[model samples]
Target: MENFIYKITPSKLNGTVNVSGAKNSALRLLAASILTDRDVTLENNPNELLDVKIHVEMLEALGKNISIEADRILIKDESFNNELVWNKRSIRNTVLIAGALFARSGYASVPLPGGCQLGDRKIDIHLDIFEKFGAKINFETGETNDTLMLTKETELVGQDIHLPIRSTGATENSILIGSLAKGTTRIFNPHVRPEVLDLLDLVSKMGAKVEVFGQDYIQITGIGGQSTPITPIVHEVVPDNVEAITWLMMAIVNKSKMEIKNFPYAHLVVPMQFLLEGNSGISFDEASQTLSVDGKNATSFEIATGPYPGINSDMHPIFAAYGTFAMSNSVVTELRFFDRFQYLEEMAKLGANIVQDKNTITISGNIKVKSETVRATDLRGGMAVLMLLNEGTDTATITEAFQIERGYNNFVTKFNALGGKLEKVFPESTKEINVTKEALVA
Candidate 1:
């Protein structure tokens, strides 16, 4: 099968969705596990997602002994050879592995990382910080690919480093390398994402001296300490604010009531405000980490994506889907990922009046969609298309759903459990070329 179709029925959606662990945070934490000489265990980690699973596979391939039980993972960094280079397939997790390798071996050579096509994610900040800690870097860039060679001279000497931006990857790299430096290392303009803090906590647990002074400054005292085996501790992962926003938008689009459990309300302040501006009634229960949505009279709204504590670029695609059902026009300005508007073409096929200008998208209200085939350009785009299929259209076929499977574990099974009619089909069987013109004439 070349494509999969979702046969959806418009009905009231009820029940609780227990949010999964933070994929972003778990990936970094898994990298931190390699810093310990003894066995380290991580709880509430995202081991189910394909990205995380592949990272785990890479770790195992590099000769790390690991085991998983429930939401906890036990990783023993008994023996690892930094000489075991990573291929293109293994480079996807380079951001996390870079920090881990630097912490353990005092040197690392990671090829340029790969991720969604969100623009140029340069490594200048990472390299600058690494250099400040007495590491020299060599770059090998070609027409289609690049690799990095990092080496340390003597013990890394810590120094105060300032970053041009609050890049999460840069901050993580600094923390990982700085922890092993000889003196005090101070990082200014640091990113304060919860995921970064989680990594700091993990490093501190491994006997590293770390302190956060303010919003964008962190100080770490470098002093090598003994490594001890630590087992996984059970700590519930924070709910995905992006996914919660997607579900909330779904409720608003359908003008139906929805109660989202295990939602990280604090992390969704911006999205909540956006919903409020649309006149969608919302209530949150902090104790239960649940968000209730009542959109009987939902209106339209406008938003622009920003960094943390703002409308995230990651949520822009789903916002497009929800905007289609608004009572009035809605605009989503993607300030972060400039090329994200391409997915609107798929929405257009579903009869959504979406117009794109550079990084902005204007969505007309109340699109009457018809069943059609669409292709997911990326992970978030796939989810956006899936949400659009929830209503409006009778049957929508989606291609390149493998991108969605990379981030969402057993997505079809989960959607089916929620009464969503979706079937996965192979690409070859469902997609055909060169037959459309002849078939159309017939």
Candidate 2:
């Protein structure tokens, strides 16, 4: 297992930090590539991310020929095995892969999805979507309900699916399956975020007709069984808005004036406006897609997580850390994932006065955080703990630090560039060898 040892010595940070391509966008975009047999190229892909690596492994298992160079990935369908029958780490995006596989091949058998342990993050909705698309689903007979098998006895035909809530994964699966299914598919109440739009852009380029009527609904015209295969084209992924906000929060808490390059301003208009309301001196350069942070301290405020154009649940922990630095009180409610309060207990070790009642959490701020060992329960929560390591000189250990790497590309390198004293420690090593900050810098 990997852990991060942080020696806090807060100092003024300088330099331009380049943001990587969006992890959420890249993962699904890779899955959408499985919808066609033609070659596809993805530029600006975050190939260094752990999640992206796992996704690549999954793609290879499906017999896709993938070549990665720098941040670009070229995928070619070679000998695709529709049945993903193997054992390895799995991500929630497997559901999307399943949808794509079902679209291309009439059957798919995949391992269950696994990612952050957010409560009630089930794929039942996804299964329902598959059923609506006329696929018969059942748990693999030999597996311990850890694998899902989907078989389409007849041709896949699209249907009108009205999602109960705005679900990003469900919406993405609908788009992927509908890309090649017969007839036009209509999806209602879809979560229209930058990542979803990124998938839409790629599928549309592949010859799927996708129409978005505001946030109300999306319609896709499938070209299944067409003589011409889905067009082979190159697509560039959008910048990661989550990583953009991570850098922004790092600037705010460390009181460092820095520039975050490749910042996706348009995708974060709502959240950026909200941060500006809290007295953050952040400026965006549209031409350069960079964010200039004046290193002003963030003020206490309240926010609720919702679908895009609103603060997302992934931003909850980052915002919680921002609130911890404010002199006043702040409250954050997790409207999407109710049991995402696992990070609150970990943040409390850093001297944050946070009290949780159901989905709402109240944080009292301005208290100096002490260096203490904590756990990175999830991706964003782990980064939040790192953001709070501003006051202590003692080493703070964050166990399962790999969680942080699963999302952010070269995060340790980026943080060290911003004057953060962080190092990764491998516990199995005889000498407790650390991937030193100097090594990363060099």
Each candidate's clash count: 5, 0
* C-alpha lDDT of residue 320 in model 2: 91
How many residue-pair clashes does candidate 2 contain? 0
lDDT at residue 106 of model 1 (Cα atoms): 72
Clashing pairs in 1: 1-426, 1-427, 2-426, 2-427, 2-430
Best by lDDT: 2
Candidate no. 1 TM-score: 0.87
What's the CA error at residue 141 for candidate 2, in Å?
A: 6.9
Top candidate by TM-score: 2
> Against the unseen true structure, what C-alpha lDDT does each candidate score?
0.69, 0.83
- Superposition-based RMSD of candidate 2 using all C-alpha atoms, in angstroms: 4.8
Report lDDT (Cα) of residue 136, candidate 2.
92
lDDT tens digits by residue: candidate 2, 189-240 = 9999999999999888888788999899999988777665455789999999
Sequence-dependent TM-score of model 2: 0.93
Model 2: per-residue Cα lDDT at residue 338: 92
Cα error of candidate 1 at position 96, Å? 3.2
